[model samples]
Target chain A: MSRHQVRVLVVLALAAYPALYHLLTQSPVGVEAETLLPRMDTMVALLYFGLFAVSFDFISGYTGYLSFGHAAFYGTGAYFVVLVANGKIPLVPSGTPFMITLLCAGLVAALLAVGIGLVSFRLSGVYFAMITLGFAQVLYVFVRGLEWISSNPRDGASVSGSTHPEGFEVGVPFVDGLNLAIGPLSGDTVTLLGHTLGTNAVSFYLVGAVVLACYLAMQRIIHSPFGQVMVAIRDNEERAEAIGYDTFRYKMGAFVTSGFFAGVAGGLFAGFRRSVTPENTFYFLVTGDALLASIIGGFGTLAGPIFGHFFDESIREFLSPAGQGGGLLPYLQTRLSEGVLSAEVGGLTVEGFIEAALNGHASLYVGIVFVLFVLYVPNGLVGAARDRLGGPVTEKLPDRLWDR
Target chain B: MTAVADPALADAGLALADATPGSVFAASVLQTGFFAGLAEFLRPSNLAGVLVNGLAKSALFVMIAAGLSLIFGLLGVLNFAHGSLTMIGAYLGGLVMVVLVGGATGAWARLGYFLVALVVVFAALAVLGLVVEVGLIRQLYDSPPIYQILLTFGVTLVLEELVRIVVSFYGLQPISDWQEALGTKPAFLARQTTLGPVTVRGLALFEILLGALTVVGIWLFLTRTRYGLFIRAGSEDDEMAAALGIDVRRVFTVVFALGSALAGIAGALLMWDPVWGASVPLAAETLLPAFVVVIIGGLGTFRGTVVGAVIVGMADAVTTWWFVNVVTWTWLPEVTVFLILVGMLVVRPQGLYGVEEVGGH
Candidate 1:
């Protein structure tokens, strides 16, 4: 298949996932499928967060400038949306459309990126990362202590019932028919083609649409001449400068562009969750999560982080304790006989062993995988796959398979 | 917002101010204005207290950052897992103290036990450092410096989670300070000591003494010992040092071990302090401040780390005092530290004692 065909195929597969999950979980072997596949709600989270990761990759991966304080932009975007909706921000009314709020969020984040980048891009490597982190941390602490954000700013601000009782809408601004409200509690349900989609499914599709739009926009930039300069800057910045490319300007541009998208992702997150917290949005760990996704997916590949996050979230859900999402522990409990479960081994029963080893300990296993990935699979999943295929998946895979 | 204009507002403000020790002055700053507040804050007692607090904080900062600076100097790897090592030390030290101390144990005996705990934690953490350096960090020596950071970050996640699991299993709250461990402190260290016009925590004096001893010990080791000379030589130019028949790789391992040992010792010290006790979040809390200190001092320079720690510690102290006495913002202290870092980077990216092209390598 051609590159475009491959791209289309991937999108089709992603589009079909929720439907496939729904059908598979209802089938005879539904329990097994449920144990493995991520739920619709998790997918919704993955879409927005995955967008953030992709934006992270756009700068750090493509240009070799690790924006360690990338969470600042994300937090700014998230806070802006929530604050605007609550009518806490100046000029922007509470009843303003969500789409406009999201746009403003992105623009504000981009402006922040420009301010940070002017100072940061002067340095390289660790210094750049540290400076950006310092800026973000300052913002994080400042936001956490702001009394006007809410009665308790440390816990973060929520979409107040007095202002935004209905869920934040996703679609054309000021058009009720086109826009779909998204939240677990307040989201809209839809019926089409004899299949009823629940709130989560509707949210999944709407959020996915926004994520797809961002991805396509970013992908276009990556394939442009501007992207070539970014890659050049990454490979040999001195050489790029020697060639009179004005590498600093390109770097700033890339940083601002990525910051904008990250903001959009954060805005989507606020819209869906209807709440914003400094810990979740502005914390260094938030940036770390994006870094993890970028690394696991394929550092330089624009589309890779989405898949990487999917893999990560799946693992987390799989190892998560029973009840919330189907996991190994819950699956084993129902499937294993009582005698086997109680069988003693190394001073603990089989059930006890599983509980001790795997229950609520997804981070341990995820961390191990991350370590292994860093050590061996340094190129990450998509990068390794591309390496194996001897070219980009889109361009080379079909040629290799057809022996052309 | 106008405190003097409205009686109810004034009363509420006064009540809020009276709720905390230094807030009366803060309320006065609001009621009486900035100059009067400054006059009240300039009192000898307050100044002396802040100075003492700053020194004690600087001592702790130096202890935590010294190891990180040492490893970065030689290996050019910013060990992200350094904080986790410190955290493990806290728990390990706490474990020793809790196990050794009894209700009948005297203050001197408790102090003696703490010394033993420090030694034990240092040794154990040193071995861990050795294992990690030889096993995980060694593999990524040839990759980009970013990979080294990534690898250590992965290590941090694993270590924290493992600690969490064990802590939870032992029926301890991983998020809060281990109160049982706090209860193991010697009575003398927990009490206040008056010196001339100023009164300070007994623990602060002990910490200052320990801090001084640590500085003297490390200084002697770095300046006087053959291994320290080797480390210095290696840090300057490893290939040249290797060509001179020095085992650079072994030096790297030694530095990594030493750094981890230092972090562990710091953790042991923190376990006794009430403000920063043995907790899971302590890793990030200490790690960030350590980073700020190292960066402000210059990434890998010991002298720079010391200077950086003092600067940050002083800033933290001043901001904290202001938060208590002059400002109502709760995050002022924390925010100031990061602001200083950002300001430092903008002003001098190379840090106080850092070379022009340190991180470039």
Candidate 2:
């Protein structure tokens, strides 16, 4: 299938899931379709991957500047949106729409990127990467010092019941087929589609929309003429300069664009989770996620992050034993050991054996996967798929991942 | 957008005015090519309270930076987990010490026990670092440098959570009977000297010497030793070094080990510092400041890192002094580095003394 076809299918699939869940199930526990979306954590995981993938794919994928501090933008946006939602900031309005908040967040982070880019752009390669990281640490410290930023964020905590705590309210309410009774300027309750759709579903859908919007915009940037210039500069900076293409402007432009998308991702994340702390907002892991997405998905390709997001989040989730009885290895054992009758056909229940084999190291599974991916499958899912298909059907994508 | 590789290379002329410590000498120091400006040495209590703080802080930076520099230079791979490695070493060292000392018998009673702990730290971390290199980092030597970061990053999260789990577990399951019934308190100074205008801790001076010795030792190891030559050769051209019959793989594995050992040493030495303070079971402040010192000095330059460390240490002391005694400034403490980092990035991108990665490096 072509890139466009895959995109259409993915979108249609996402759109269909919630709608189907809406009609079939009329609220599980005063619950609704949004809350009961299959693997809600997986959806959140997708948002996190999508955000970084947008910005990282631009510079790392397109421009070839291996930045180590893209999290600065995401964190900045996250802190701002989080601060506003918690009524911590005086400059911004509290409890604003998630979309408006995302724009503001993007703008703020983009502004910071502009300021940082102005001074640090002169240093090329490793120096630039280090400078970016150093500056980010400074930002991290700054955020950590803000007592306002810490608000015990519910890590995508689900709200299935009709009655939430008095303090709990969805800041960005996606009210449809259900009435949301607002108590003046105090708190807003979301009765999503027939059931009282809790804050989690509202935040999840809000974040999903923001992440999708950012991803689409980044796709456009990847195909833009200016973005092409950024890639040219990455390929051979001096050559681009020699060819009279103002390489500095291209690099800076990419940096700003990347920051803008990163901010959108952050804002959405902060608002979605209904809280933000320094640990959650400014994690190096978040930066790593973006870097991994770019590397694994195949750099300089629009479809790469879409593909990379699936692998980085879904595969890790598959490996992870978070509140689950089995992981990929366990499932594998069951699949091989029990075939469809692993419990019924294989005629044996071996959940305990699988657990014992795991040996209490969930991260070990994640680490092994990461190491193997970098070493053996460096071009990532997109690259591997492209190779198998004998090059990209899209003109914008490179035959090789390192076209930049 | 302001994007420049080295704004320090392109001089940002933001001059100061009036009578202050740095104002008069600043013109000649920054404007003139001569390295004439002194680091504004200790004057208040005569023993370098500020200077010693600065110096010890420099050592801290040197400890982490030297390891980071070695890995980056030799392997041509930026160990993303270097910071995480420092954190791991610190927590591990702390756990060992706490397990020993926090027990009824006390850790200081058995000095040999401490030595054994050091050996354990070295072995464990060295093995861990090698595993990282062989398992993940080895592939990037032939491939692009970008993937090394991603791989290390993947490892970093796994390790951080693992350490968090381990540390949290140690709290639940205290090391059983770690105390060896040796009521020994190792030679930690209960002495402070008031000399001339400097107020110095006895331990501070020892740390300064240790830092100096480390720098001298590292300098010799890099420039004068055979291993040092091979490291330089490898950093310059790994392909060439390998072709010249040097086992680049072994060199890399050793470099990773040495780096991990240095981080371990840093974690151990930190026990004697003032920041650890009176009655804290475990401290996390060490790693936060470690990054500051690394950034203040350019990444990869050991001596520059020492200078950066000292610069921050003194700044912290002086700023606190100014905040408490003079201006009553709360925000000035954090701004010190913000101002300094911008000044460093804008004025000297290779740090004060970091030799720029010459040519291919």
Candidate 3:
């Protein structure tokens, strides 16, 4: 198969996921599939958040400048979208199309990146991370206290019923026929052929489309000559400078571009969820999640973080407290005999042990996996795959298999 | 200054302030303005209160940040799990206090038990630190500095989740202050005492005392002991220290243990304070400020940490005062702390005493 064939295959697989999930969950093997696979709603979250993580990797992994305050851009994008919809922002009408707001969010975040990069790019390594973090934290605190955003800003702002109550759309700015509203309840549903897609399924496709676009854009940049300089700067800043490349401008450009996509991701999040909080959007741990995704997926790979987040969200859903996605505890409860569950070990019943060890404790397992990856799988999943292929996977894998 | 010293001048100043504005003007601007707040802040009583509060905060800052600074100085690894370790210390300290202290126990005996709790927490966390350093951190010594950070960050996730499980299993709210632990505090420490014009919490005074003692103890360890000399030497140039036949690796292990021990002790202290009681989220809350303090002081310098703590503590106290009395913005104090960090980085990226290339490594 060719590289383009592989690309097409991947996109087709992603596009088919919701339909496949629907089909598999209702088949004779439904129970097993339901127990293992992530729910459609979780997949929707995975798409936008995966985009944020990919953007994080774009600058941090590619340029070797960890944008530790990357959440600031995400939070700005989210807040801008919500605020504009609520008519809180000046000049921009609340009736402004959702796509326009999202684009504006990206632009605003890109502008913010320029402002932050001006000061931040002066420092490198840990100092750069710390300064960016400081700036984000400053914004985080400011937003949390600003009553102008809401009656209770600490709780965050929501898309109010007074304005834009139908939900944010995710297509062309003015074309209603092309646009699809995205939310759990407020979203639009579609019936295609004999299959009827629910709100969540529709949202999954729409959000996935946006994420795919962002990914392709980032992938193009990574494969460009500009991206070569970014990698060069990461590998050796002095050498890049010696070769007459103005490393700082390239760094700033990369930062702004990543910031734009991160903002878009945030806007998508706000559009789907219809609410934004400082804790979820601007907090340092949000950046940590992106970092985790980048590390697990393959730090420098453009498409790696998405797969990384898929792994993350799957684990989280599998160990979720309520077992909303049919997790291990529920699966065990259905599979285990009464006597086996009641059997005692280490002063606790078998059921009790599982509850104590596995239930709602996905973070523990995820953390362990992350540590192991850092230690043994330092190159990450995609990077390791590339290593096995003896070069970039897209270019080398095809040659190894077909050309030979 | 004159208004603070002389009653007549103060009265005259008040009269002039009262005469200057309409009631509407006073309500809208003068009552909430910076100048009015500044005048009130300058009063001797308010000054004294803020001073004590600032000192207490500085003490806590110093205690939390000292270990982080020390470990980074030698290992060049910013221990992200330090705050989680401190959180564990709070719980362990609280556990010791809750188990040992009874309703009938006197304040002096409670104080003694608190000391015992501190020692127990320090020892336990030191052992844990030893295990982590030897098992996890040691393996990443060959990798880039970022790996160590990533490793410690993973450790934080595991530690916090484990704590959450235990805390919840024990029928306690992991997010809120553990009231049972707060109940273990001695009566004297829980109450307020007036010193002339200033009123201060007994816990604040105790914190200041413990903080000073900790500072003095670490200072003596660094300046007077052979191990301290080795640590200082190792921090400067570990390769050179190794060439001189000093066990640099052993020094790293020891400093890591010591740093963890300091975090534990700080957590134990925080457990007794009402403002920051034993809680899971305390890890991030304490961690961020500790980061700011360390960064503002320069990443790995002890003296700079102390100076940075004082600056941050004073700023926090002042902002808090303004929030309570002058400004209605609830995030003023918290925002000011981060702003200081940003301002400091822009002005002097190396920090007060940091070498320019310290973070580069």
Candidate 4:
């Protein structure tokens, strides 16, 4: 398929996800779809992460400058949005519009990127990587000490008007009709297309739309002429400089762009999570998640990390405990106990094996898969597919993954 | 290590060495105002405690950093999983110690068991090192340097999760028991020995001695042994060394194993000393500091690693001692280390002992 076709297909699919998920989850006869289909809230959360990873891919993937402290922008955005929305910031009063707060969050993150990039861009390679990490840690400590933001410094402030107190009600953008009543808001049901949808189901569509918009914007940036310069710098900085490209300025631009999108994702995350802590917001490991997603999806492919994150979250959902409901492991365990697989292998059932593997070591499998991927499949899932097909059919997508 | 690496560093080291404690202290007060409130904040007893504590901390950093430096110098890979290896060693060592001495009758018997367990842990890590090199690392030597980092990172994740899974599955009580015993201030390591006005724990002194011994052992091996020559030569010019009828590949394997073993010993000592008790997060937490030490000291240089460790370790100790007492800024300790790390990178990106690589320095 051509690049345009694939992008259109992806956007259409994302747009249809809520309806498809709703329908697919509904099982035959008496079986409830709730168990089989992930909860709407879960889907929304996955979309948030998908967006986050996609933004991460925009800079690190294109420029090959692995920002180990990317979470600094993420936390800044999350904290800013939540604080502004909750009337914590003096200038930004309480009940500020969510979209405005979100935009402001992105702007703040971009400003932060400029300051950090100016100092850190001087170092290259591993030194650059460590310095970014150090910068993030400094931010992490700073937020952890601010007790006024939240009553507890360690556990940071939450959106006061979130789902808990009904201090705010989220509705369709620009539409006067009351939508998903969150926190202590309103009625549980939202009527759409002659069907009454739960608040979570409405939330899924709302967040999904935002995520789709962000992804498209990032995709546009990735294909722009400026992005090409960023890629050139990644491949060879000296050559880029020799060509009179002003590689440093181009890199700074890419960094700011990446930060802005990452901040948007952070704003969405705050909305979904309703709370933000230093550990959850600014931790270095959060950047690792984006890196992991980019690697798993395909570095330098703008949309690959989004797909990677979705795949990751789905797998995690499948293996999670029974209380979550509809977990594949629990279902497998039940089936194995009733079937012949339980009797084989000297009495240790397939269920036991699965249990053993999933017993707090799910990440081990991810690590093993990562190593194997690096060794055997450097291009990741998307790149390998592209290569096998002899590259993208789209003229817009060059033979290379990074090429627009 | 090699003609003093950088003369400026050598001069600074010598000058600092030549300065008397009183003079240095007075200068610090005058110049940086670093010791302005020292009289109010630190008593004689507190000073002794911080010094002894700092020495022990430096010892730990040195042990971990030395192995990391050796591997990076020889293999040209950062070995992100180095901390995980140490973590594994600590867990294994802790388990063996508990099994061997958990049932021992007397203090002497327990001491013997502990010693035996440490040796066992070292050997185990060496064997693990061999397996990792032969099976995984060897294939990636020709790949991009990032592959090595990613590979080691994956290995670290796998090992960390594996440790967690194994402990949960096997109901590994020794792991938790060791933590608990250490938390309660175990009788075995509770006693302190007073030397000249400074009271120091026997375990701390032993760890310090071990650190010193590792330095000497590694220095001798590097300077006097044939294998060490191969390692040094390989690091400098692998192709050239290979052309000269030397099995550079075998040298890499040996050096990697030895480095891993050294990390294992450090991990085992940490378990006994209860410094950040062995846990799943140990691998993740120890990684940055080790990276900082290697970078600050100069990549692949033992002397640089030692210097970096001291710089980091003493900064941590002094910051903790001062901030915890005077301002109660618990967060300053981490900030101090980060400041040093950033300052070093901005001033000397090649590190104190390293030659230039990326050209900034």
Candidate 5:
């Protein structure tokens, strides 16, 4: 197949994922009261995170610059949107349209990224990582200190304001009645094609559309001539410089571009959750999550991290509690507690043992899986598939995935 | 070292000297008011307290960073689990304190029990290091640095969760119970003691002494032992050392063990103080400052590690003091370390003592 055919197929696949997942998990009951709604919600959330992971791969996978501070940009975008919506910013009025605020947030993040890149890109390898981390730390502290940003009005500014309280509406302009239901919204359900859809399901389509656009734009950028220069810089900066390309400028541009998309992802996240916080948006662990997704998906593949996160989120959801839509662990816990199995095992209650062994430890298993991947499947699943398929699949995969 | 000789100090002195009669009168009035706070802050005891605290903190950073530096130098592997090792040591020490030392009646007996626990902690971590090296790390010896980093990071997460699960299983909460169980009665370490114009805490003094001993001991071991020579040789060129019949694999194992032992000992000692006791979040939190220490001191250099730790610790201490007292910018102190790190990277990426790396990327 030609390259263009593969690109179109990838886009079609991307568009099909949410619809297919929604349909596959659909229940006989209306979607509003359906048990599968939570699962759909998770998949929709995965798309936004996939965008974040893709942005992360742009700098890290292509440039070989592992940014331990990419969360700085993500957090910037999140805070920007929420702060504007809250009427905290002087320039933007409160209850402004979500799209305008999101764009402004992306712009702010892009500008900040350029400044950070100028200072950080000077150092390479581990030093670059440390400095970027340091920059993020600075921002984290700075934001945490702001009394106005995180305080409750009742208890005054001293009350923790890590999460914004009053949720904002995300809606289309000129559409008076249809506010996009991005969360566990109340009231009536929207119906399409005689199928009832809950607020979260509607929000899923909205977020999925945004995520698709962002991914296409990013993929186009990665395949452009500018992307060629970025890959060149990543491979050999000195050689790229020797060729009179002004490597620093190229790097700075890539960094800003990455920051802008990361911001967009962050904005989507804030809108979906209807809240943003330093812990959620700005933490180094957020960057770590993106890094994990990119590595597992196949770094530099652009589209691979999307699937990587899908796998990750699905596993975590499966491991979650029953009320939260988990299956295996929760089922086992219920059976043990109900005396469906022997409570006593070597004088230890089976239920208690299960709780002790598995309660809140799913992330630990994820970490272990990450290590195993790094050690054995360094090129990730995409590369592994190409290798196993030998010829046909290899030819169809992105050039960057197999280029090295 | 003279106040007048320092350019900034000279400028300040000149400004004071240039004060007009009216300004002098105003200064005298202000001295009793705004200047009073400054004068009290400059008191010898207060200044000594800050430096002592700074030294104690630096000692902790140095201990953790020393282990990290040693591992990185010897194996070219940046072990992200170094913090996890330290945290495990702390938890084990806490158990020893609660289970063993709790049974002791006398202060002397308790002290002896604590000392024994430190050795046990070191031994346990050494064994852990051996297992980790042989079972997991050995397989990735020829892998890229990123793989080593990711593997160690995975170890860190797993170890942190394990610590959490184990601590909870023991029916103990972090900070309060762990600290009460681990520390000695009379709580001498946590209490401040005054000596004439200087004031210091017992734990701070102990930590400083321990830090000094650790640095000296490592130096002597490197300069005076056969194993140390082999480690240095292997670190320089593992293939060459192997060719020379140095048993490089054994050296690598020993190096990892030694590094973990240092972390274990540090963790055990830190348990002496109630404030810095090992907690799960600590394993993750310590990773950055440890890296900052390694980078600022010049990676893989022992002297550089010590210097870097001291600098970072001092900056933290001074900033905390200033922010709390002088400016009241509460958030600024927490970030001062990162600012210093960024500044250092921008000015000198090789660090103060590091040789310029050829084709560094």
Candidate 6:
């Protein structure tokens, strides 16, 4: 098939999965509740993040310099979008539509990326890692202070002050003791290009759609001269510099580009959730997740982070072994139990014993596995796939799982 | 060399310089700054109380971060899951203490409980560290340090949620039974020493003594022995050291073991004194400062770790004392540390004492 055909097919496949998942999980098809509407938005947000995360793969994984501090941009966008959506911008009368909020989120994140990328782009490897990590942490802490902008009452606006607090103090009460304004909400049925599409399914599809766009953009960059320069920097900076490449600009571009997706993801997250809080954004772990996905999926490979992202999200749930044998063993146990039942020998049942053995302490096991993965499989699933596929190291395989 | 020679003297001047000034200082330092300022701890009687608490708090952080610094300096792996390790140890240790207190029918059982629990923490952590080394860190040994860090961080996330699950099942949070169990013997500040109303804790003496002993043991282990020399050598240039007939692989495993053991030991001690809960996310807090200490004091410098820990401990103690409730400004602690780190980075990037090693570009 042609590249465009392949791209269309890829989009179809991705769009179909969430709908399929919804079909399998949610009873009855597409009769959404008001509360459930948020989930649709949230799915969109995750899709946005997924797209952004894949974009991150371009700079971090493709370039081989991992940054665990992108949350600065991500969180900045999330918080900024909420501020903009709520009309939290000073001298502005009120909030904007959710769409506008999303734009502001991306713009602000991209802007912040430019600023941070300027500073952090200088270092590489561990030093680069530390610089980025430190800056993100500083930013996370700084935003927590911006409680006024995020969801603070002292920002000359309160949800209750805007509308009225029924029982509590303000608007929609958030997780950590903050409330939102009643209704300056500028939402107008989730739409795209004047099409009155089914938002429930389309929201997630839009996420995939955006992700595909990001993937293509990233592909273009990775193949472009600038991107090749980034790879050169990653491989051998000294030689690159000696051969005379202003590697700094390349690094900055990658950093900012990586950050742009994260910001987009953050904005989507805010619009999806309809609120933002320090609890969600001000965490180093969130940044870690993106990095983990990129690494595990395979560095510097377009298809790597997608595999990493989905695999990470899935593995944490399945292999966790904490939540009652949720992964492989549980499926086996269910099937096995269909045939017969075991009598309790001691104080514990067979089920209880199995639960205690595996599910009881999932983190302990997950930790062991994570450590084991690093020790054994450094290049992650994508690397393994590449090696087995028997192609040139950087080129895609015939039916490459990572590639579209 | 001042306190380097006399460990006892080192404990005094570093009584923590509470530089924030008065009540504003106290509030900004501790979450309980309000109660302490308004009533319980601000009185003349409580000035001694504040000093005693401040000293103890400093000592606790210093000791915990010291071991963490050792591990990071030697291994270059920031075990993000160290705090969880500490938390697990504290929880288990507290359980033993509780069982001992309740079922003290025989003295053997009581003694057995303490010994067994100590062994449990140390052994568990050592094995855990080994597992991590063999499983994750060993592979990343050749990759960029970020891979190592992220891998550990992934473990930390999974482990923390798992811990929450385990705790919820066991009917506990991170810090519930620790205070009561460890603080069984009420330790008030001894009123004898009248140096500006700072009376030291009887327990504080024990902590200081232990800290000194640990410092000495580590010093001897690294400086006066073959294995110690191997450790120092490996930290300097692992490839060259391996080339020179030292089993660098074995050294990596051992260092991880030793480092993890130290973390476990710290957890055991922390559970009894101050670190029973998740509130003191000891790993993250101690990890940063310890890394800073390891860097500033000189990476992999055993002597440097001590000096660095002392600096961090005193800073933490004084700031914690002066700020918690005193300043009521959330940004102060972070800002203070950021400033310290920035200053250190500008003047001494390899750390205050660290000699940049090979393998890290």
**Model 1, span B1-361: residue lDDT tens:** 0011211112112222433322422343455456755765577876777788778888999999999999998899999999999999999999999999999999999999999999999999999999999999998888989999899999999999999989987889999999999899999888777777667788887888888889888888988999989988877788999999999999999999999999999999999888888999889988989999999999878889999989988888766665555566777788889888888888899899988767773
Candidate lDDT scores, in order, read 0.88, 0.59, 0.87, 0.72, 0.72, 0.58
What residue pairs clash in candidate 3, if any at all? none
Candidate 5 CAPRI classification by DockQ: acceptable
Identify the superior model by DockQ, candidate 2 or candidate 3: 3
The C-alpha stretches of model 1 lying farther than 4 A from their native spots are A402-404, B1-29
Q: If the candidates were sorted by their TM-score against the true structure, best first, what order would they fall in?
A: 1, 3, 4, 5, 6, 2
TM-score of each: 0.96, 0.73, 0.95, 0.88, 0.87, 0.77
Better of 2 and 5 by TM-score: 5
CA error at residue A343 for candidate 5, angstroms: 3.2
What is the Å distance of residue B198 in model 4 from its true position? Answer: 3.3
Better of 2 and 4 by lDDT: 4
- Name the runs in model 4 displaced over 4 angstroms: A29-38, A161-164, A167-189, A333-353, A393-404, B1-37, B172-188, B358-361
Q: Per-residue alpha-carbon lDDT of model 6 for B1-361, expressed as tens digits?
A: 0011111122333323332432332333444344544553345644454455445544555556555565566577666666656656666666666765653245445545656777777787788788877876777766667677777776776666666666655555443444555643222312134346554445556566666766777779888999989988877777789899999888888878777776666666656543233323545554554455555565556666676666665554444444333444444455555545545544565566666552164
| Model 2 interface DockQ | 0.18
Q: Which candidate is the best by DockQ?
A: 1
lDDT of 2 by residue, B216-309 (tens): 8888998999998888788767889999999989999989888867766665555444343211121224444555565557555555566777
Residue B67's lDDT in candidate 2: 75
- Candidate 6 Cα outliers beyond 4 Å, as residue runs: A1-6, A22-45, A91-93, A97-100, A145-199, A315-346, A349-369, A390-404, B1-58, B103-120, B154-166, B174-196, B199-205, B274-285, B322-326
Model 6, position A140: C-alpha lDDT score: 60
- Model 4 chain B poorest 10 in a row by lDDT: B1-10
Q: Considering summed lDDT, which 10 consecutive residues are worst modelled in model 4 chain A?
A: A178-187
Residues B1-361 of candidate 5 have per-residue lDDT tens digits of: 0000111112112112222222222232222354654675576666766777788779878987888888887787878899888888887887787777553467767768788888899899999999989888989988656667778877887787777777877776643436555555335655566656666666677788888889899988987999888877876677999999998988888889889888888877766655556676656556777888888887777788899999988887766654444443445556788787888888988776655551143
True contacts kept of each: 0.72, 0.25, 0.69, 0.49, 0.61, 0.41
Pairs with backbone N, CA or C atoms under 3 Å apart (clashes), candidate 5: A150-A161
Assess candidate 4 and give its TM-score to the true structure: 0.88
